[model samples]
Target: MAQLEQFTTPVDAVVSRMRALDAALPARDGVAVFNRVYLTVTEEVDRRVGTGGFPDPRTAITLDVLFAERYLTAVEADGPDRRPPACWRPLLQFRRHPGVRPLQFALAGINAHIGHDLALAVVDACRSLGCAPAELEDAYDRVGDLLVSLEERIREELMPGPDLLQIADPLTHLLGSWSLERARDAAWSAARALWALRGLPELTAEFTDRLDAAVGFAGRMLLTPLPD
Candidate 1:
């Protein structure tokens, strides 16, 4: 129906932009690496939306687009006057470091997005849809589940071989210290808290700033360069 197509237009536009970025950047570039992972996830979400996988397709599409736009905005904020959010600064700054492995790049981006962007995206969706955070929970959980399912695949594809990944490997410890499951949990909590504070603009802004800084610190630690 025309209504369904109207709802999906934004999702398609975001997907097209991501695909363009995937083509534009080199495969090993840090932003490109995460962009590929995110593009695939977005495509999957789009497919599911068309197939009735989401009970509330409109909400799912809106959240997916809103969530992705945050990252795309960061990507475009390259000018001196357009700084990215604190949570995204680490990945953009260290994106070209020779000692930072591909897995680190991927996870660092994930941390910035899920830990920081997802919560804000939830609030964005609420405002757009004129609903509460609880109303968006099902769509949020579904999207989170898709990301969680892809995390293992990402690790398998990007992690170094066993010879380089010894039990004492710093990479092993670093990766183990940051779990996608936990990040997703925290984002959900933050989304609820943000929704509760929506009426208090000053407190909401302060809380959001702290969350951004904290997540950025974690991202910085995640991107620590290891010896090649």
Candidate 2:
């Protein structure tokens, strides 16, 4: 595995990348950074779910995924190509560097955000579902289970390894982020969509919008750490 120091300094590059993609890089850099870091963090959660022994990884992974995905969906709906994919990938790779640990710490913060987002969305959906406290826990569990199954696929394709941090950091972080908290919130959101009475069983425009917005935010965040 390549040492993290092998790559160019990430913090410096973040500045350049953000500016390269968008001239207005500094205005909303925090949200941008938050989104990117959050995405990477969630990806990690997803991975852990599959190859993991953790008891409740599902809920967090799915919940965080949904919020982020939904946020992206919303952003796309509102704007166009706000964040290029190219910008986010390298930032993630830097974080996943074999020798680096700050990215891992940032991931914890990302998880916290995922949990918060999921809890809020779950509470919102629960009101519509009329789900009781006990039932809410059950709802979370169901999604958590599905996430674990999905993680099996991810792990099979890409198990955690030394090279993972170096080669495909974004994807690695993405897969790892799926956990019980995320999955639980996602399940709740899924249920809430049904409560809308549309019988809609597909990704809605709103979800897409949120997903895109989140991606934009992330892209910007990746650039925030760099120098102009």
C-alpha lDDT score of every prediction, in listed order: 0.92, 0.41
Task: Estimate the TM-score for candidate 1.
Answer: 0.97
Residue 186, candidate 1: Cα error in Å is 0.9
Cα error, residue 204 of model 2, in Å, equals 27
**Model 1: per-residue lDDT, tens digit, 1-228?**
577789887988999999999999888889999999999999999999899999989899989999999999988895688889999999999888998999899999999999999999999999999999999989999999999999999988888887785522898888899999999999999999999999999999999999999999999999998986
Candidate 2's error at 223, in angstroms? 12
Clashes of 1: 0
Model 2 residue 153 CA deviation in Å:
1.9
Q: Candidate 1: which stretches are off by over 4 Å?
A: 166-168
Candidate 2 lDDT over residue span 165-193, tens digit each: 55345545543544544534554554455
In the order shown, the candidates' Cα RMSDs to the true structure are 1.3, 15.9
- State which candidate has the highest lDDT: 1
lDDT minimum window of 10 residues, candidate 1: 160-169
TM-score winner among the candidates? 1
